[model samples]
Target: MLAGLLSAGVPFPKAIELADPKDLPDKFRDFIVLAFELGAPLVPTLSQLEVQMRHEERTSQEIDQAQAVPQATRTLLIWLPVVSFVLAQIMGLGTFSGILHPVGALAALLAGALLFAGYKISGRMLNSFLAPKPDPTLSLMVLRICLSAGEPLEKIRKRLEGYPDGGASQLVEISKRTGARLSFLIDSELEQLNQKLLSSRIEEARKLSVRLLIPLSLTTLPAFLLLTLPPIIIGFTQ
Candidate 1:
């Protein structure tokens, strides 16, 4: 609707005012209006948003690839206790009581602790995609857009109060500088910022798979042993 209105030659601010950002953060309502008043073009902001969506898609694919095996392993570990119980009953071992005997009870208690630990680990693994943090790159890109248009850094900071999480560190000295040379400088800074953001995400994904292994070995493996090993030994001895 905003695009259609803009195409129909409705003034940019009026077009934005007429269009509602449903389900979006209300802070954006003021942020976008401020951008228009600063003479920033809608095209650049939309282009940056496009870049972000693409990046998120790529990141999500990476997360799924990284999480698949760990998730399967976790599911198997979590359910082995139920399977162990059924197997014991089928083999003529006294069902829950055989597993609930004093020593067996100790084992079950330990297994419960490990199950809880494994649950926490799995939650963290899954949450990498589910609970997304604020993207620092987004605010940086907006800074680039507004600064390239010659807006002052102080004004940008004031407008960004409730927007993306970012700091004034990068733009502090930048505000004092100006001229034809500044365009090249901004381009270099934007490139560096993009690289930093991409690299951090890549590192995080790489670490996730390695980190999940600890919980699997420490908690899930022990959990499986607690649920299955005792019954097997008792079944053989009896």
Candidate 2:
């Protein structure tokens, strides 16, 4: 809508006002408007930004989809033993009588504790995946877009808050030393940022595959044994 409106010759601020607030962050919208006001080209810049945002959204959704099966499996792992015990009782396996015995009661308590610990630990691990953290590269991206405004370096730096002093500063320095265009250098940095972001996502997914095993081995397996074996042993003795 932003690009379409820009192509239709609507003013930048007005176009932003018309666009959905949910589609863009307030900081980004303000920076884009500032860039345009500072003489940056509108349609091309916004079009590229729109595409990047869409890709990020899609990537986030893909990560969530990737997590779905694992999440469901985790729930099942945490509940399967309890469900089995109930089923054994329902089937007249004498599990209730077993559970009434001292050893069976002890096993049940231990199983409950293991299940609780596994649930909490696994839940925390999974939540870490979805935790919201400020993207470090976001500051650089904002700085890059704002740089298009063609303002004096110091003046632009002052206006933009949270501008990273590392990559953005180096790109600006390199542009000055080599007499290269600052905007072009920033675009290259943005490309590198994209690659880094992709790599991080891949690494996170890899870690998730391994991290999931911690709960299975540490708690769920023991809980399963306790919940299943005692009932079977007691039923046999009875």
Candidate 3:
């Protein structure tokens, strides 16, 4: 939509003004507006940004798909014992009757607490997984835009939200030694940054499979046994 508007010679800020806020992300709109203010080449910069955003979106979707089965299993692990206890009581199996004893009541409370803990911990794990990964290329991206716009490093460091002083200095040093354009060097770094982010995401997914197992064994399994065993023991004794 932005590319079409720009191609048709709509004024950059005017094009942005015309867009619905819901249709455009605030950060993206701000980036476009700032890039225009800095006199960066809007078309190519936006094209590159679009490609990166699409790739990140696809990666996120893939991670969510990978998580589906584990999430379902977690739900089942959480609910299966509770459902069994309910059914056992309904079927006149004396499940709640067994829990009417002082000892049984205490056991039920402990099991309930464990089950709740497992549920809360599992949710926290999922929240951490969904949290945004730190972008290694943010400073480089800002530098690229600044260099393209002929903005000074001091100006960028002061004005740009995430432009890092260290990264800017390193890029300048490399440019001086290699006689390379800072823009060109930053582009190469951006490519490598994408590859690094991909690898990091894969590692995170792998670790999540392991992290999820912690609650299953430590809390959920114990709760399941605490709930399940009493009924079985009672039936055998009867």
Ordered from best to worst lDDT, the candidate numbers read 2, 3, 1
RMSD of each: 4.8, 3.0, 3.1
The positional error of residue 190 in candidate 2, measured at the CA in angstroms, is: 1.7
lDDT of 2 by residue, 69-112 (tens): 66876788888888988888888787778888899999999999
Worst 10 residues of 1 by lDDT: 22-31
**Against the true structure, what is each candidate's TM-score?**
0.64, 0.82, 0.80
What's model 3's TM-score? 0.80
Let me know the TM-score candidate 2 reaches against the reference structure: 0.82
TM-score of 1: 0.64
Judging by lDDT, tell me the better candidate of 1 and 3.
Answer: 3
Clashes of 3: 0
Query: Which residue pairs does candidate 3 place in steric collision?
Result: none
Evaluate model 2: give its lDDT.
0.74
Task: Give the winner by lDDT.
Answer: 2
- Candidate 1: tens digits of C-alpha lDDT, residues 11-124: 967865787555334434444555576676665554444454455556667666655755676677667766776787787775455465666678878888988988887777
Clash pairs (backbone) in predicted model 1: none
**CA-lDDT, candidates in order:** 0.63, 0.74, 0.72
Candidate of highest TM-score: 2
**Candidate 3 residue-wise lDDT, 18-83, digit = tens:** 754346555566666677888998777777666666666777677777777568767888887788
